[model samples]
Target: MSSSLLIALILLLSLLAYWLGCRRAVTLAQRPSADKLHSRPGYYGVLAGLWCGLPALLIVAVWHLAADPLLTRMAMHGVAAAKGVASPDQVDLLVNDMRNLVAGNVVAHEVDPLIQAAADQYVGLQRLGDLALAAVALATALGGAYVLLGRIRPALRARNQVERIVEIVLTLCSTFAVFVTVGIVLSVLFESIRFFQQIAPADFLFGLKWSPQMAIRADQAGSSGSFGAIPVLTGTFLISGIAMAIAVPLGLMSAIYLSEYAGPRFRAVVKPLLEILAGVPTVVYGFFAALVVAPAIRDLGGLAGLSVASESALAAGLVMGIMIIPFVSSLSDDVINAVPQSLRDGSYGLGATKSETIKLVVLPAALPGIVGSILLAVSRAIGETMIVVMAAGLAANLTFNPLQAVTTVTVQIVTLLVGDQEFDSPKTLAAFALGMLLFVVTLALNVAALYVVRKYREEYE
Candidate 1:
């Protein structure tokens, strides 16, 4: 049976166990000589369900993890013996071909009689393993349910055991998440180190040119590629700066108006309308920027006798700012609303005007949250890929002029890793280096934002 079907059966058994446990608990509670139950009948039911499902799930997980590799190794050993020994790479290729054939996927090479027989053997082994797994898991679930039901009584600590088991599961999930994050960071860091070893760190970091094209052969034209990240980094900050300039004022003002000045009817009608921008896919925004905004900017620049690239930073930044406005406005509104009404009342008691109270009392109280929201908006802008790719041309120009074409770190990373390229090449590894740089920049921004929040955070009794 498939894992999903097996899991479904286990769950169905658990439900049956829960019903039986609950009925037994009720019967015991009604008995004349039975003492009061330590926990509720529902708790007993839940504990029985946990016992029924958890051990079965654990067996399924462990079985799959251990069985797949063991089966693959056994199949590969047969192929190696039949094929009269092969290199590790050749053996891996054969293994892949065998598995692909077994999975009904396209194989890179023609399947001979030997590989076909091996594929059949592998399939037979998998079926046998799945059958064994299903039998063991189902038996374990039934056994656990029987044992727990026999032990369930008035004095059983069902709720305590259930809570402890839940706590352990949550902790395991949290630890897994942390490990995944660390693994990603380490993978990127290692690849970046390899890239820097080939291309000088100083050159990659400080070079003005951003070409990453390297020739496959020594005699090919343009074999030397520049890996300077300066232009890309400049474009990133310039576009993000323009986006922030447009977003911060508009978003903060709209938030203030919605939270403080606008009446309930208008606020309710308008808030969702503004937030709708956030739900629009970035690709749609990209198309809008490319088709509508970019052309309009170019025309306006021409009318003003200024040169504007067809794809400029200003166009992308403007649309991105519009896209992220909801992030700023929604969070700021929530923060401002959370500011104590008592502070406003006290400010009014002191004869301060509404504007004065907002400026002196409410705004100060909510400044930390406002800062946090703006920081979030800034991060969103920096990390945006589609709008920048569509609106801003991938020229990687270092110019600060919004009218000029530019590219960001994310755009370059995408460009580098677009096709099937070998990771051993500096060209491909450059993506990881750029990724590491972007990660550092984002981390620094978060650190700065945290410092600002801590420095200005307020307390009130």
Candidate 2:
């Protein structure tokens, strides 16, 4: 069972035990004052339940996360004391090799007998941790019940204890998400730093080329791939801008129509149709871009008397815009609906027409939420991979014209790490650097969006 589910089962069993104890107490004491006895008895049951369950569950969570890395560390130390591997790099290499062996992988060198033994020890230690934790949790829950049953007699303060336990349990659940997000950010931050060591920060930030080549064989072709991200970033920004141009007006208008204008029957049909865009696989969009959209864009450019590449930015951008329309519309609609109906009634009573009330009152009230949706859309556009990978040319063009071809950070990251390649090369490391940049950029977008939503929400309130 998942640790979470096991924890839940333990808590549930404690609750059941508390209920049985409380029911028995009530049956034994038949006094009228007993119905009023000790905060209605149910409170006593819950209090006992919380006392039995909460502490051990917290320990289990801490144990699960700490177990793997701790055992790995122990295994690393074991290997360090072994016969062959002595240096730091060698230790790291041995760890990786041992990991591969456990997964039934072929290692670089013939496997050392001692290192293999150490790998077995790590796995065994992890199993032991799991077994020990389960035992401890069961023991603690049973022990807690034994104590709480004694305290369940009349005159004990049970309701307050139950409430306090509820508060702590809720806080623990909420903190879990925050902890996971922080862990991910720290992991990415460290990996990115390792990558930046291979290529200078300034060079990566300012360089003009992006062909990351591993010079494995003699006389590898092409100028060493420019790791400079400006061009790809420009492409992402340009295409995302184009996408927003198409999506915002179209999606928002559709949202306004659906939420404010469309009848129930029409909405029932159209909302699903709009969301169907989201359900469509991006890879399918890629195919459509390559087969249908690219040619159509090229022809339109031809009619406009402008030279356009077969694989152009306009095609990818438009397709991406289509992909994101449902996201913006769905979010905007929910935010608009969340606005108070009394505010709308006041606007209408003041002789505001439907359009004017919606524009001036509802939109202003929902502005923060709308801006959040747009920021989310912008982030989605930036991180989008398959459509850009197939339709937009892989060449990183520094130009701004939407009619011409351009690449993006996500696409390049995909190409950089697509095949079998050495992890030590600048090419591979560059992917980490780009990923870090992408993460940072998205993090900023989300922060800005949330800030806008918070400020405006306060204004509305």
Candidate 3:
């Protein structure tokens, strides 16, 4: 049976166990007296389900984790005995070919009888492993259910035991998340180190050029790749700055008007419409920017006797700002509304007008949240790829002029890593270096934002 089907059977059995456990506990409490069961029937049922399912799931997980490596070893032995000794790369290629043969994919090289035998062995072993896994998991689950059902009694501390299991599961989930994040950072850091080994850190960081094409063959042109990132960095900052300039004021003002000044009827009508902007796909926004906004900007600039590229940072930034508007407005509106109404009343009692109360007291109290909202908008702007790629041309221009075409770090990272390329090459590894730089900058921004929020957060009694 398939593992998924087996797992589904285990879960069905667990549900049966849960029902049986509940029925047993209720049967034990037939004589309803003042002194009754220690734990509730629901707790007993949960405990039974946990006992029946968790062990079976663990068995399934262990088998899955071990099966691939064991099969690979067996396949490797058969191939080696047939093909003689081989290097690591050759072994990998042979294993890949075996896998292709097993999967019915066309093999790159000529196939032999030994390779066909190895492929057949791989398939047979996989089927045998699946059968073994199903038998073991079912037996373990049945045994766990029998033992736990036998132990179910009026005095069993089922609630405490179930709570402990829940806590452990939650802790494991949290630890898994932390480890996954650390793993990503470490993977990027290692690849970035490899990239830096080929390109000098100073040259990569401070150089004015941004070309990353390196010729693979001797006769190929443009063998020398420029690893300079200054232009890319400047373009990213310029576009982000323009986006923030457009987003912050409009979003903040919209939030302020919606939260404080607008009446319930108007807010009820407009707020959902405003938030709908967030749900619009970014590709849709990119299309809008490229087709509509870019043309309009080019025409307007021409009328004004100014030179503006058809694909300019200005168009991308404007559309990106519009896209991020809902983020800022929604968050700021919630924060503004969260400010205690008593503060406004106190300001009014001190002869302050509504605007005065808002500007002097309410905004001060909500400044931290407002700043956080703005920072979120800025991060969104920085990480944007599609709108910038479509509206702003993918030129890593150093100039800060919004009328010119520009690109971002994410765009360059995408450009460098899009095609099939060797991971060890500087051209491909540069993507990881760019990714590491973006990660570090984002981390610093988060740290600074946290410091600002904590340093200035109002302590209201």
Candidate 4:
């Protein structure tokens, strides 16, 4: 049986087990001489279901993990016996062929009779394994239900058992998240170390030029690429700064207006419309930047007798700013509205104006959250690539002038890894280093934001 079908069957059995267990518990309670049940009837039902499902689920998991590699090994052994002394790559190809034949895909290479026989064996073994798995899992689940039902006395702590199982599952989920984060950090760190070994930290970190093209051979054209990352870093910050400049004030003002001045009906109509900007895809924004915004900016600059690159930081930054406005406005709106009503009432009773009260009492109270929102917006702006790629040109010019063409770390990382490139090359490795840098920058922003939040957080209670 398919795993999905088997799971559905197990679930149905568990439901039956739940009903029986509940009915038996109720019967025992109604008996003249029986003690009152230790826990609720629903707890008994849940305990029975856990017993029926958990063991069978474990069996399915183990079989699913182990069955594929085990069957592949056996199949590969058949191929090896038939075609003596093949390389590891050849063995893998033959194994793939066996799988393709079984799955009815067109085999890419010539198929031998021995390989065909092995493919047939693979199909037979897989079907047999799946059948055996279904049988064993269902039997285990049924047996567990039988045992648990027999043990379901009036004094059984079904509630405690169920709670313990839930606790373990939650703990596993939490630990898994931590492990995943640690794995990402370690993988990036290791790759970055390899990158830094090939290029000096001083050169990559501080040098002005940003060229990453390394000659494959000594005779190849172009100077063995400049690994200096300063230009990319500069462009990233310039665009992000421009974005934040446009986003923070406008977003904060919008939040203030929505929370303090706008009536409920107006707020309802406008807030969702404002937030619609956030839902727009980045690629759509990219197209807007490239097609509409860049041209407008260039025309404006030309009218003022200034040179503007077709793909300039100003165009990308403006679109990115528009994209991040909702994040700030929404977060700040919530934070501002969360201020205690009593604070505002007290300020009003003291003869303070609404504007004065907001500036003195409400804003100070919501400052931490506002700061957090801006930081989040800044981070979003920094990490944006599609708009930057489509709007800003990929020339890594180290300049802060918004009218000039520039590139970012993310853009360069994408550039470096676009085609079939050798992993060991400094060019490819540089992408990892840039990635690590971006990671560190984002981490630092989070840390700084946390520190600022804690420092400025106001306790109302």
Please write out the lDDT profile of model 4 over residues 1-461, one tens digit for every residue. Answer: 99999999999999999998899889889999999999888888888998999899999999999988898887667567578846888887778877888788964666777778888887789999999999999999999899989999999998999999999989989999999999998998898999899899999999999988777767778668898889999999999998898899899999999999999999999999999999999999999999999999999999999999999999999999999999999999999999999999999999999999999999999999999999999889988999999999899998989999999988998999998998888899999999999999998999999999999998886
- Note the Cα lDDT for every prediction shown: 0.93, 0.83, 0.91, 0.92
Looking at model 4, residue 146 earns an lDDT score of 95
Residue pairs with clashing backbones, model 1? none
Best by TM-score: 1
Order of models, best TM-score first: 1, 3, 4, 2
Per-residue lDDT over 139-256 for candidate 2, one digit per residue giving the tens place of the 0 to 100 score: 8887887788876766666777777777887897899989998998787677678878877899888887666765755577644556788887899899999999988998899989
Could you tell me which residue pairs clash in candidate 3?
A: none
Candidate 2 yields a Cα-based lDDT of 0.83
Please give, for residues 1-461, the per-residue lDDT of candidate 3 as tens digits: 99889999999989999999999888888866734889999899889999999999999999889988789788668567567746888888788888888889974567777778888899999999999899999999999999999999888999999999999999999999999999999999999999999999999899999888898667788658898989998999898998888888999999999999999999999999999999999999999999999999999999999999999999999999899999899999999999999999999999999999989998889999999998888888889999999999888888988999988999999998897887978999999999999998888888888988999898776
> Of the candidates shown, which would achieve the greatest lDDT relative to the real structure?
1
Q: What residue pairs clash in candidate 4, if any at all?
A: none
TM-scores for candidates 1 onward, in order: 0.94, 0.77, 0.93, 0.90
By summed lDDT, which 10 consecutive residues of candidate 4 come out lowest? Answer: 106-115
Please state the error at residue 316 of candidate 3 in Å: 1.0
Error of 3 at 424 (Å): 3.1
Give the least accurate 10-residue stretch of model 2, judged by summed lDDT: 216-225
Please list the Cα RMSD from the true structure of every candidate, rounded to 1 decimal place.
Answer: 2.0, 4.6, 2.2, 2.6
